[model samples]
Target: MTEEARPESPDIPAAEFEDSDLLRPIVESGVGFRVTSSLLLLVLLTGWVIFGRQLLYGLGVTGLNQPVAWGFYIVNFVFFIGISHAGTLISAILRLSQAEWRRPITRMAEVITVVVLAIGAFHPVLDLGRPDRALNIFTAGRLQSPLLWDVSSISAYFMASTVYLYIPMIPDIAILRDRGVWPHWFYTFLAWGWEGTPRQHAVLERAVSILMVLVIPIAVSVHTVISYIFAMTLQPGWHSTIFGPYFVVGAIFSGIAALMMVMIVLRRVFHLERYLKQVHFDYLSRLLLIMSLLWFYFTFSEYLTAFFGNEPSEMRVFFYKVSGPYAPFFWAMVVTNFLIPVLILSFRRTRTIPGIFIASLSVVIGMWLERLNIVVPSLANPRLPLPTGYYIPGLVEWVMFAGGIATFILGFVIFARFFPLISVWEIEEGRRLSVAETTERLEGYLPDPLPSAPGQPVSEGG
Candidate 1:
C-alpha cells in the first residue's frame, strides 16, 4: 500500500506522523472544496432573504395555523434531530463493543451529531407563531408540559453530545497545533496545550471513557423527550406508551442511515476508501439493516395496536395515514425504509459499495417520511372532526430547508479541508489494537507462534 494509504504503526510517534493514511487524501483531494464554499455563501444569502420575509410578514406567511401549529419546520426539525442521533449512538456502541473499524468513522459521526442537534433543536423557536414571545417558554413555562420536557432533555443531549465530540477532538486539535498549519492561537486555545505526555494522555482517556458512558443515556433521553412532546399531548395518534422507545429506535435507524450516506459521500469525495475500507461499509450496512428491521417492528406494533384497538380518534388518524391524502407519503415510507433496504442488504452479494449506497439512500428517504408521518397525519385527523386542510410549506420554509442542508455540507466540507476528516492518531492506535486482538483470536484457532531459545533468532510468526 502507498504511504498515504497506510496508517502509521503504534511504534511511530504521533507527533512525527504529519499526515494520516485516513485523512491525508481528504486534506489533499480538493474535492468539494470550492463548490461547498460557493454554495455556503448562496445558502447564507438565501437564508437571510427568507428570514427577512418571515420578519416582515410574520408567521402568517407560513402554513402553520390554529390547532396545527407545526408543519414542515417541525418535520425538518425532527428529521435533523433523528439524524443527529447517528453519531453519538454509533460512536458509543462502537466504543462499548470495541469495534476496530470504528476508528476512522467515529469523529465524523460525532461531529454530525453535535452540529445537526444544534440546528434541529433551534427549529422549534422558528416554528413559534409568535417567536418574540418565545421566552414565555421560560417565564410561563410549565414543567408539566411535554414542551418543557423537550426543552430540558434536548438541551441536556446537546451539551452531552457536544462534550463527547469536543473531548476526542482536543487530541486531534493538538496534533494540528503541532503541525503549525492551523491558526496557531485558535488551535492552541482549543488544544489547551495538550503535550501528549503519558499523564495527559491517561487523563484524557479516562475523561473520554467516562463521557462515552454518560452520553448514551443522554442521547436516548433526548429522543424520548421529543416523542413525549407528541405522546404526552392528548393527541389521538400519539398518546401511547410505545412512543418513547419507538422514537429512540427510529432516531437511531435514521442516524445510522445518515452516517452511512455521509461516509459514502466523504469516501468518494476525499478518496478515503483506503482508510474507510469496504469492510467498514459492509459492517455498517449490516447495522443499517438491523435498524431497518427494528424500525419496522416498532412501526408495525404502533400502527397495529392503534388499528386493532379501533378507538375513534386513533382510528381516524391511523386510517388517514393509511388511505387518506398522506397515503402516498406513508406507503412510500414503508417501501423506502423497509422494503428497499431489507431486500438489498439481506443478500451478501448485494451488500457491495454501490448497493449499500442505494440502501442507505432509501433509508434516508424512508426515515424522512417517517418523520413526516409522525407530524402530519395526526394533525390532519384532529379529534374535533373539522375539515382537514392541506399543508404546503411556504417559500420561506423551503429556502430554510435548502439552507439547512447547504449549511451542513458547508460545515463538513470546511472541516475536511482543514483537519484530517479521519482521526489519524486513532487509526494508528486501532492498527496496534486490532492486530493484537486478531493475533490472539488466530492463536486460539491455529498453531501458536513458534518459541525460540534465549539467544536464538525468532521466527517471522513471532
Candidate 2:
C-alpha cells in the first residue's frame, strides 16, 4: 500500500521523532500502563460476574421493588448515557465550528461516547431480570411504547457513533499500518485501503462533515427521546413539558463535566501535557461552567412552574425532594451542580486546573444526584393509594455500578494502549493549515474588508 504523506505541523518539534514518541503508548515499554490496565480488567470482570449472578438469581436478589423498582441501574443508565453526550455532541459542535482546540479532545470524547454507551445500554437488560429474552423487544414489543424509542434511538446512536469514531481514525490507523505496529493486519483492515490521495482526503473530509451534521441531531434525539420516557408519563415530576429540554441540558451538563474529568485523567496518565494543555482545560471548564448555570436555570424553572401551579400532588413530591426523605440528596445535588461549580469556575483565580478539577468532580457527583432526583422521588411517592416506597440499591446493583465504571476505565486504557489518544494527523493538519484556514474564515466575516477604501487598489477578490 502507498504510504500517506505526513504533513508536518510547524508547531510540532522539528525532530519528527517526537511524533513517534507520542505513538509510544501503542508501541512501548510502559509498566504502569500494563499494570493499571490489568487491574481495571479484573474489576470489569467483577461487574460481569455481578451481571451473571443477577441472571442466575433473578431480579429478586437485588433491591428493586414497588415504586422504587427503577433504582440505581436506571439512575446510572441515565447518568452514563448522559455522559456519552459529552463526547459526540460536543465534538461534533466543535468540529463544525472549526474550533482549533477540538483536535486534541475529540478523539477521547468519541471514545467516551462509544464506551459508555455500551455500558449504559447494558442497564435495561440488567433491569429486565432476564436479559437473554431482550430480543423480545421485536417479538413482543410495541412501537407505541416509549421503551421502543429508547431502544431504537440508542441503537441508531451506537451505530452512528461507532462509524463516526471509526471513519476519522482511518488515516491514523493507516499510519500504524505503515509503521507495521504489532497489530499490523488489524490497523490495515481498519484503515480500509485509505491511501490518503488528495481525492481520498477530500472524500474523508466530506464524509466527516456529513456525519457531523447527522450526529448532532441523532445525539439530540437520543436524549430528547430519553426524556420522553418520563415526559410521556403522568407522574408528578415527569409530566412537565420542560422535561425534554431539561434532560438534554442536564445531559450536556453532566457530559461536559465527565469529559473534563476524562480529559484530566488522560492528560495525566499518557503524559499528554503538550497536546492537552492548560488552555484546553480552561476552555472546557468555561463550557462546564456555562452548563452549570443552564442546569441551575432549568432546575429553577422546573420547580417554579410546579411550585407556583400549586398542584397538590406535584407539591407533595416537591416537598419530599426539598424537605422530606430525599432532601439531603436534593440539596447535595444543588451544592455540587450549582454551588461548587459556580463558586470555583466563576472566578479567574479559581479556574485553574485544580479548581476546574474540583468543579468537574463536583458536577459529576451532582449530576448523578440530579439523575437520582429525577428517577426516584416521584416514583417513591406515587399519587396512588399505595404507601410510601423507598429504594436502596443492594450489593448486586452497587457492584454492577462499580463494574461499569471499571469497564469504562479499562476500555479507555486498552484503547490508549492500542492507539494514540490524540489524532496525530489532525493535529499535524491543524498546525499546517490552522493559521491560513483561520484567516480565510475570519475574512468571510468582515464585509469585504471595508470595500477596500472604495477603489483605492482593491486587492484581488476584495
Q: Tell me the TM-score of each prediction against the true structure.
A: 0.89, 0.94
| Model 2 residue 194 distance off true place after TM-score fit, in angstroms | 2.0
- On TM-score, the candidate that comes out on top is 2
Please report the candidate that would top lDDT against the real structure: 2
Which 10 consecutive positions of candidate 1 have the poorest summed lDDT? 3-12
Residue 262 lDDT in model 1? Answer: 91
Regions of model 1 farther than 4 Å from truth? 1-32, 437-462
The sequence of per-residue lDDT tens digits that candidate 2 reaches over residues 1-462 is: 232354432322333454566688887848988799889888878888877878888988788898787889889989999999988999999999989999999999999999999999988888996688899999999999998999999999999999989889988887777777887889888889976676778889999999999999999988898889888999998898998888889999989988989988878877888998888988999898889899999999999998999988899889989999999999999999999999999899999888888999999999999999999988998797788888888999888988889989888988898888898888878867788989998888877544546657655672
CA lDDT, every model vs. true structure: 0.82, 0.87
Clashing pairs in 2: none
lDDT of 1 at 443: 81
Ten-residue stretch with the least lDDT total in model 2: 6-15
